[model samples]
Target: MTHRGAEPPDGTGFLAVRCDVTDSRQVDRAFEEAEAAHGPVTVLIANAGVTHDRLLPLMREEDFTSVVDTNLTGAFRVARRAARGMLRVGHGRIVLVSSTAALHGAAGQSNYAAAKAGLVGLARSLTREFGPRDITCNVVAPGLTDTDMARALTPEQQSELLRRTPAGRAAHPDEVAEAVAFLAGAGYVRGAVIPVDGGAGLGH
Candidate 1:
């Protein structure tokens, strides 16, 4: 599902359903459409997020709430819906996409960091609640991925961050996706936060 209803490239066998994570009805409808076209959803990757960077003092209430609503609450909305189908099947996998900012706070990203950090707690709680039924939930925290978000950063900002990273480079998107794929297939790995940050968050 995507907010803009974007389709995968031809031959990918993906269905592009328009759904906004912020709306419960949209979440439900997307699942219904997916299930109708394919089957019950057994794996969910909650990756919807938006960033509104600002210092705490300069951030408005809306700024903080909007980020949280999309990043944290949005994951919650979709996960709740997906859990229904997983419960019926008695097994499933959930992977939450978090970020390194969650572990090592950024100077002007309190809202984004808080929301991403919340994902860890959410994954842990879901693991406990669903473990007995063979449902596993985990988080993958990626740092400075080579995505549009990273590209949006100024060159100097990117250079500064890479200098701090042990690898001195941003991660390929595939690297992060590989971690998610691993978690989805591993039955025993529950409530684990696997870092795919090129050692950027090694201590954390």
Candidate 2:
């Protein structure tokens, strides 16, 4: 998901380009197409991710690498390409979607957690390198959300999760989107980890 606009006179809306972050070629082409339609990408939301949860003893090496490649390295690939255009224009906003598990840890999601945590480092480095050029980078860490992903949990499981969350409920997807929008619109904020986790990751 990405946003690029300042509410046009008619408020038409944004363009949605499908790009496979795992494929560098596809990522490059997506940007080219978007640029042709709108202009250089001024805001990018690197939200491509996948989860492969398994206990460490049972986790296959392929599972770990695959998640990291798509979630962590995939963001790197897309961000690297997007930075080219942003640097040329001298302004941009980069918001990467991470997970609460990145900080709190999950029972069977070591790979996913590690990959998400990597985004924090990536955003910070980008902030340092691009901040001087009027670009900002940040992370949005979401907790359990009312999405297909959250539906995977059973009723009992969902209840258990809510019991632990201070909000006592799953977040609506729009709630997460709102945070991303705020970061995209903010110019002064840079390299910040803004968690929409319902206070689940307070200490971290």
Candidate 3:
């Protein structure tokens, strides 16, 4: 999962490893390591994702499956494990990072859209299962953020995004982070998909 990209903390508290979220073993290791040190995950942010933006006819089978596995099922892997701990502790938070494509269709992004859309269902299911235990689950869908991943757009593509988006520009990564932060900390929000799309995905 992507973080703030800031350097590691000077205090050297928790150990964060580079893990492929789709791989169950790696997901397990992340929890094990974090638990071995700090504690069972009290809060989880399922932000793992990937994109394979080829047209459907040209997109490889692996491209499609990989996106689903990483972006959707990967969140499940962490949630299932973390739920066990959260259940035992009786309180937790889970924020699944989705995308505006989950609600709005986009050309050449079928795989991404499907995976992201699935997160909404996942979040809702978690809320139903865990909300009574005080474990809130929600989704945060970010729009076109001005990160390296978004800047990959061609000039025309970027221009089209600006024109279509009521905000008139792409969002900053920090803005998306703020959405995640609020829902993660809020006490009542559950099974909601908070969009940080600057009105690009409004009315969806």
Task: Give the alpha carbon lDDT tens digit for every residue of 62-97 in model 2.
Answer: 999999999999999988988998999988999999
TM-score, cand. 2 vs. native? 0.90
Q: Write the per-residue lDDT of candidate 1 for residues 79-174, one digit (tens) a residue.
A: 999999999989899999999899898878999999999999999999988857889999999989998888887798788789888988999999
What TM-score, computed on C-alpha atoms, does each candidate reach? 0.95, 0.90, 0.91
- Every candidate's CA RMSD: 1.3, 4.5, 2.6
List where candidate 3 sits over 4 angstroms from the true fold: 1-14
Give stretches of model 1 more than 4 Å off: 1-8
Worst 10-residue lDDT window, candidate 3: 1-10
Pairs that collide in candidate 3 are none
lDDT of the structure predicted as candidate 1: 0.89
Deviation in Å, model 1, residue 90 alpha carbon: 0.5
Alpha carbon lDDT of each predicted model:
0.89, 0.86, 0.84
Q: Pick the candidate with the highest TM-score.
A: 1
